[model samples]
Target chain A: MSERALVIERLNKIFTTPNERVVALREIDLQVKQGEFITVIGPSGCGKSTLLKIVAGLDVEYDGKVELNGQQIKGPSLEKGFIFQEPRLFPWLTVEKNIAGDQSLKDPKVRGKVHELIRLVKLEGFEKAYPKELSGGMAQRVSIARALLRKPDILLLDEPFGALDAFTRSHMQEVLLNIWETNKTTMIFVTHDLDEAVFLGQRVVIMNPRPGHIKSVLPIELSFPRKRSSLAFQEMRRTVLNEFEKVEEESYTVGAGI
Target chain B: MTVEISEKLSEPQKKKINWLNVTYPWIVPIVIVIAWQLVGSLGFVEEHILPTPSKILTTFGTLLGNGELFYHLTVSGQRVLLGFALGVGVGVLLGVMTGFSRLAQEVIDPSLQMLRTVPLLALIPLFILWFGVGEFGKVFMISIGAFFPVYVNFFLGIRLVDQKLIEVSEILQFSFWGKLTKVIIPSALPNILLGIRLALGTSWLVLVVGEMMGTSAGIGYMIQDARAYAQTDIVFVGLVMFALLGKCSDSLVYAIERKSLKWRDTFKG
Candidate 1:
C-alpha cells in the first residue's frame, strides 16, 4: 500500500440552484495517510457529502484539486469505491449478481473473490435473494461487497448507516471495523452522529455549518478496538462535543450583533 | 419501526380468507345464467329475437360437430397471432431506439404522438382503400391497433428508470451498453409488460372489427352471416366464442406477467 493515498487541498464548492448560489464548501483542506479511517461530522448543509463527492470524482465543478495516489481526480473511476446513504443496490438483481455484476469479474478467479466478499459481509445463504426480500442491513452488506469487489484503494461513504435502526447501526459499525482491519483500505466516512463519528474515526474532522469548512481536526491516540465507554474514548467524545458548542455560541453571538 | 408495524398488521392478513370471499367473483356470472334460463323457460320473449339458452347450446353443438366452428376459430387465431407478432416486433425496436437516443426521440416521438391521437378504428376505410377485400387489410388493422400501446409504454418505461440506480452503475464505470442491458431494461420490465398486456387486448378488440369488414371464414364473419339470415342462435354462439377466446388470451398474458415479476413484493392493499 502507498503511504499517501488521498489529499484534498484548498477545496471549494458552490451549488447553483435555479434560484440561488449556495456555497456548499469553502477553503477545505484535509489529508489522510494511507489506511487511515477518517470520519467527518457536521450539521446539515455543511458540505460533507460534497467533500466526499469531490474525492470520489463524482463532482469536478469544485475549485480545489483532489489527488489519489499522485493522480489528480478528474471524473468517476473504479479505483475509488463509493457507498451512498441508501444501499443503492439494483432492485432487479439478486445478492450474488449485484456483487459480481461487473463483466470483468465474471472470470472464475474473480468470481471466487466475490464469494469471499459475500462471506466477508456475512451474507451467506442469501446468494440468490432479491433486494426486496432482504432486510435493510442485509441489503447494505451486499452493497459493501459490491464496492469491495474491485479492491479499491480508497472507500468514500456518505451516511451509509444513518437510515438503519440503532441495533443494526451498531452491528454494522462493528462489521465495518472488521472489514477495515482486514483490508486496511483508506476510508473516509461522513455522518451526523457524534457517537458514530468518535467510534469510527481514527481522526474526526468537525465542520461548521455556513460556508462549510473544517473547524478542527482532532486525532484519537487510543489503540484499535477502542471501547466506547473507556476514559480515553469518552474524553475524545467530550472534546468533539465541546468544539460543536463553542462554534454554536460564536455563531449565536455573531447573529445577535448583526 | 415501520417493519415492526407492518409485521403486526400482516398477522390478520395471513389468516384464512372467508369462504364466501374466496368464491366471490363467480357469484354474478352464475346469477345471470340462472336468470336467463328462467326467462327462456317462462317464454318471456320470442324465440327468434331472444334465442333461448338451449337453442344457443344446440347451435354450438351443430357447429362443433360439422367442424365449421373450428375453421372460423383457426382463421381468426392466425390473423391475431400474425398481426400481434409483427406489431410488437416493430414497436419494441422503435421504442428501444427512441429511448436510447435523444436524436431518435426528436425525430420520432412527435410523429408517433400525433398518430396515437387518431382513433385506429376510424382507419378501416383507409385500410380498405389500400388493401381492399383481402386478408392483408384485416391483418393490417389488427397490427395498427396493437402498435401504439406497446410503443408508448416501452418509451415511458425506459425513460423513467430510477436515477439512483443509474448513478450506482455510473460509479461502477459501466459502459453505455452495459447500463442498458443490466439496469435500464430490467427496471423498465414492469411497464413493458403492462404495454404487452394492453397490446394483446387491443389485438382482440381490433380483430372483431377487422373480421367484420369485407372478410369471410372468421367468428366475426360468421356472426354477420347469421344476422343476415336471421339465425339468432348461431349469432349467440359466435358472441360466446369471442368472449371465451378473449378471456383465454388475456389470462395467458396475465400468467406471464406474474411469472416475470415474481421477485416483486407488492402490497396487497
Candidate 2:
C-alpha cells in the first residue's frame, strides 16, 4: 500500500501559437503512493487540468517526465482513466453501450462486468436510456462508470462535477469518496472548490498561478463518513480558505513585482 | 384536458378556435374555386387558358379510368427511386471517406465543390448528349441532382460532431474502425437523415426535367404532350400528381428518420 504508484518530476508545459507563447505549467513535482486520494485545488489558470492531462498521457508535449508504476507514460492506456468536466457520453448510444465503450471487452464473461458497473453506479434501471435523457448528476455518474470499466490503477478526473448544481456536486463528492474507499484505486481529483478539496483529498495540493506551481500540500485528518456541518469540517474548510487567500495575495504581490 | 380547455373558452374564444381549427384552412381554396367556376361559366376566361377545378377533376377521372395517369406515375416514381438510392449511397460513402481522411478531402473536395456549384438542371443538355435519349440519361440526371445535398450535409455533420466525444474514444483506446462506426456515424446521423430528406426533393425535381427530354411515358412527358395541344386540364392533373408524389416520398424519409433517431430526446409535442 505504501508503494509509489505515480511520479512526476519538474513537469513544465507551454502553449505555442503563431504570435506568442504562454506558459501553462512550471516545475510541477508530485508523487502518489498506491491507493491515495489526492485533490488539486487552484485558481482557473493554475494548470490543475494541465497537470492531470500530462499524467493521463493526453498531453505529451511537456518538458519533464511522468511515470506510472515505474514506467514512462507515452500515450493513453487502459491502465489510467481520464474524465473531463463534461460527461462526454456519446449521445447516440444507450447508457450501457456508452459505458461499454468500444466493446473491447469481447469476452462473454467481461460483458457481465458492465452490468456490475451499472449496479455500482446505482444506474441499473436507466441502462437503456440515452445521455440526453439523463440528469446532470446521473450523466456524470455514467462518466465515472465508463472510466472505471477498465479497472484502471489510477483515475484522472478534471472537475468532473463542476457543471453539476451545488446539491448534486456535494452528493457526487460523497459518492466519489465511497467509490474510492471501496475500489481502492489511486485518484487525482482536480477542482477549484475549497470545501471539496478539504472533504475529499487525503492531501490537498494548493496551487498558485502566474506560471502555475504548487504552493502548499495540506493533509486532512478527518475520518470517513465525514459531516460537512461538524466543527472539525468547518475548521478544516476555514484553514484551507485562509491558506488560499494568503496564496492569492502573495501571487498578486509577486505578479505586480512590488 | 380538452374538455376543461373547452369549458374555459368564452364565446369569442370558441369562435376563434372553430375558425382556426376547422374553417380557416378551407377559406382560400373555397374562394379561389368559386371564382374560377364563375369565370369559366360566365366565359370571362377562355377554357383552354384557365380550366376550372371541375374540368381538371374530370380530366383526372378520365386519365385514371384509362390507366394513362398510373403508367406515367409509376414510370416517374421508378426513375426517382433508382436515382435516389444510387445518389444517397455514393454521397454517404464519399462523405465518410472525406470526413475520416484529410488526404481524401484534399484530393476530392475541390472537384466535388466545383461540380456542386454548376446548376444540376443545366446539365440536362450534356446528359442527353452523353446518354442519348435513354432511361439511363434521365436516371443519371436525377442522380446528379440528388448527390450534392446529401454529400454536403453529411460532410458538415461529420465535421460538427463534438470533439469531446472523440476524445472519449481516444481515452477508451478505440480502433480506427470502432471510432468510425460507433462514434462518427452515429453522431452524424441526424444530419445524414436531413440530407436524405433534402435529396428526395431534388430527385423528384430532376426526374421531372429529365423526363422532359426524350421520354414518352412519364408525368413530365404528359405535361409536355398536353402543352402542344393546349390540354390545360391534363397539365393541371400532371402538376397535382407531382405534388402528391413529392409529399409521399418526403413522408417516407421522415418516417425513417423518426425510427432511427428514437434515442434522441427531442421535443415531441
Candidate 3:
C-alpha cells in the first residue's frame, strides 16, 4: 500500500454569521494516499470547496484534525499548491514570470524549471505572453503550470475548470490527466461535474449539502484514457448520478414529512 | 493581378493616413492662430489689448535672442523638479505605510484628509510669513499642491488591490516585503501613475502662483514684470511657454503610462 499523504479525522467546519452559525461540513473523514487522484463531487453549498480550503490551510478554523504526513495543518505553505476556479495569473507578469513567481528567473535552474513546466503545460512559444493576451483555457494552463512549479507534495484544485466552456473543459481534463501521469503528485480535485469526477479520479467521493457530508466513496476500476462515450464510462457516470438522485428523493420525502 | 495593384496603391495611402494622424491635433489651434493674426493685421483689436500672433512671435524671438527666456525657463524648471520630487517621495512613502498598516491609516488618514480639503492658495499668506518670500516658501507651496493627489490615489490603489491575488500570495508563502513589491505595488501602478500626472499639473499651477509673489527670475516673474511695463506681447510669450511646457510634461507621463501599463486589456477609445 502507498503511504498516506493526507488524513482527515472527524473534521467539522462552521461559519458564523451575526444571526446564525452554519455548519459547512460535518463528521467528514477521508484519507488520501501519496500519488493518488481523488475527485470530490457535490452540489453547491456542499462544503467541498471549504474542505479543500481547510486542507490547503487557507481556512484553519475547523474542528477535528487534518494532518499532512503526520503534521497538523496550520497555515498555507509552499508544500500545498492550490488552483482556484479562475486562473489567478498576475496580469503584469508574462507566462514564464508567473510560473517563476517570487523566485528569481536570473538563476539558470529556476529559468530551466519554468521552461520545463511551460512545455509540460504545452504553452510553447508563449513564454512572453501576458495573461490578457492569452485565452481563458491558455491562462488556466499557465495557472496549472504555476501550481506545479514548486513540485508541491499535494495540489488542491477547487473546480478549476468550472468557468470554461464544455469543449475546453474536456480538453483541460485530458491535459490534467497527462500532468498527473507525468508528475504522480497527489491531487484532490473538487468539482460538480459527474463526467469529470469519473474521468480523472481513481476514487470519487460523492458529497451532499444541507450540513454537507460524504454520502459514499466510489472507486473507479478503469484504465487510463477512458473513453467518454464507452459503455463502462457511461455506466460509472450513471452510478454517480444515481447517488445524487437517491439523495434528492430522500430530501424531498423529508420535506414532505415537515 | 487586382491584389498586386491594390497593394501598390495602399503604400502611399497608408502614409497619407499616418500623416493625417500626426497633423489632425494641430488643425484647431492653427486655425485659431491664423484668425487671430488676421484680426490683428486688420486693426480689429489693439496689440496691447490682444497681442497679434506675429507680435508675440517677435517678442518671443527677442527674449530667445538675449537668453532671458532660457534663464527664466531653467529657474522655474529647477524649482518644479525639486518641489515635485519632495512631494512625490513623501506621498508615496506615507501612502505605502497607511496602505499596509491599519493602525497607521487610523492614526494618519483623517488628518491628511482634513488637510487635503483646506484651500492651498489661502495658505500663501501663512507660508510667506513663515518662510519670508524666499526660495523655501515658493518650493514649499508647490510641494503642498503636488502632495494631495498622489497621496490619495496611491492609498486608494493599495486598498483596492484584488483580494484573490492576495490569497495567491499567501499560497505562495510570500514574505511581507515580497507581497508588497511583487503583488501590491504592481497592482497599484495604474492608479499611482494617474496620481503622478495630476500632481504634475498641480505643481505647475502652484509654481505660477508662487513665482507671481516672491522670486524675480522665473517665467511668472517675467509675466508680472511685463504687466507692470504694459508689454502685452511679452506676457503672451510667457503664457505660450507655460502652455508648451505643460503639454510636454503631460506627454512624457503619458508615454511612461503606455509603456508600464501595456498589460491592461482596456478599451483604447
Candidate 4:
C-alpha cells in the first residue's frame, strides 16, 4: 500500500583477483517499502554486508539495478546513512562535535539538533567527552546519533552491535528501535544473530552463502515490543533459525563435495 | 594490628616519595654544579681552560646587566622564529599538496626525499655564495634546516590517515575543503606537531652554524667574538645560553603537544 523506498533487482557482485574471481552476491532482488524495517541474516561469507555496502553506494561495481525512490544508486550520498560494525567515531571529536560533524555547531539550530539527538540516544551528559573517553557502547551510540543527524532516507546498519556484549547489544537494539519509531526512516539491518533478526525486523530475509542470494523472506505478524520469551516470538525465531540452519548445512555439504 | 601500623608508616613515606619525585631530576645537575664549583675554587683546573661556575655566573650577571646577552638572544631568537615560520609554511603546503594528490606525490616526493639525504650544513658555503654573508644567507640556511623534518613528518602523517575515516568523510558528503580541514588535517595533527617539534630543534642547530659563520650579532657571534679574545668564561656563558634556549623551546612544543594531543589514549609513562 505504501510507496516503495528501495528496489534491488537482479543484483550481482563479483570480486576479482589475479588468482581468481569470486561471486560475492548473485541475483539479489528485494523491495523495501517506506518506513519498513528489514533484517538480513546469514552465515559468514554470506555477502550480506557487501549487499548493504552496494545499497549505500559505497560499492558501485555491481550488476543489475539498486534504485532508491526511482533513482539509480550512483555513489554514497547524504540520503543513505551507513553504520559500520566498528563505532568509527573520530577520536579528536567530542560527542557533540562528532554528531554535529562538518555542520557548524555555532548555529543554534545545529547545536539544538545535536543536543536532541544526543538525548535521543540517551547520551545526555557526554557532550564534551571525546571518543576515546567514552566506553565502546557509548561511542557506538554517538555514531548512531551522528547518522541520525543527517536525517537520511534510509539507514543501513552492518552488524553495528556485533562487538558489544550481550547486555549492551540488547540495550542498543532497544535504542535503535526507539530511533526508528521516532524517525520512521526505512532501515535494512544486516546481522548474523538470529535473535536480533527476529526481534527488530518486520521481515527477516534469510540469505545463503557460496554465491550469496536471498533464500526466503519471512514476514513477522507480531506487534511492537515483541518479547523474546513469548511463545509466538519463539515460534517465529525458530522458523527463521530453521531456515538459517538449512542454508548452513547445504553450504557445508556443497563445500565438502567440492 | 600490624597492617594498621604498616599503613600509618606508609602515609608519611608516601609524602616523602612525592617530594622525591619533584626533586629527583634536579639532584644530579645540582651535585655536578657543586663539584665543578669546588674544583674551580681549589684551582684544580686553569680558569682559561675551564672557568669556575662562580666566574661563569659573574660573566652571566655582567652580560645581563649590560643588556648584551638580551640583544644577542633577541637576534638569534628572531632569526630562528622567522626561518622556522617560513620553513613550516612551505613544508605544510607541500605536504598537504602531496598528501591529497597522487600526481603531486609522485612528482615531488622523490626529489624531496633525495634532497633530504644531503647533510644540510654542507649547504652553508653554497648559501653564503648565493645569498652572500648577510642575514638573508644565515636565515636561509636555518630555514632549509627546518624544512626537511617538517616536510617528511607532515607527508607521512597525511599518507597515514586511516582509510576507514576517509570512508566516513565520503559518506558524510564532505566537500574537498571540508574533508581537508575536518578530517585530513585533524587526523594528521599528531604527526604535524611532531614535525614542528623536530623543525624547531633543527632551526636552533642551523642558527648556531649560521651565526658562527657570518652574523656579528647573536649568541653564536658572541661566542665567536669571545673565542678571539680568549674569554673562555664568555664562551661557557654562550654555551649555557644555547642549552637553556634549546630546552625552553623544546618545553614550549611539549606543552603544545600536551594540550593538543590530550585525546590520544597513549601510555603516560
Native A-B interface contacts kept, per candidate: 0.45, 0.56, 0.60, 0.47
TM-score of model number 4: 0.93
Candidate DockQ values, in order, are: 0.36, 0.36, 0.44, 0.32
Q: Which ten residues in a row are the worst by lDDT in model 2 chain A?
A: A102-111
Between the candidate structures 3 and 4, which one is better when assessed by DockQ?
3
State how far residue B37 of model 4 sits from its true place (Å): 2.0
Give lDDT: candidate 3, residue B147. 88
Name the weakest run of 10 consecutive residues (lDDT summed) in model 4 chain A.
Answer: A124-133
Residue B257, candidate 3: alpha-carbon lDDT: 92
Question: Please, what is the TM-score per model?
Answer: 0.89, 0.86, 0.94, 0.93
Q: After superposition, how far is residue A111 of candidate 1 from its true place, in Å?
A: 5.0
- Against the true structure, candidate 2 reaches a TM-score of 0.86
iRMSD, per candidate, in listed order: 5.7, 8.9, 8.4, 10.2
CA deviation > 4 Å runs, candidate 3: A252-258, B1-17
Cα lDDT of all candidates, in order?
0.87, 0.87, 0.91, 0.91
Residue-level lDDT tens digits of model 3 in A40-124: 9987777899999999999999999899989999999888999999999999988899988888899999999999998888887
lDDT of 2 by residue, A93-208 (tens): 88888888888456675569888888888776676677877889999999999999989999999999889999999989988988899899999999988888888998999998
lDDT of 4 by residue, B1-269 (tens): 43553355345325544676879989999999999999988989999999988999999999999999999999999999999999988998898889878999999999999998999988888888899889888887788888888988888899999999999989988888878887888889899989999998999999999999877899999999999999999999999999998999898988888877777889979
Error of 4 at B178 (Å): 2.6
What TM-score does each prediction get for chain A alone? 0.94, 0.95, 0.97, 0.98
lDDT of 3 by residue, B127-213 (tens): 989999899998888888788889998999999999999999899988888888789989999999999999999999999999998
Cα deviation of B39 in candidate 3 (Å)?
1.8
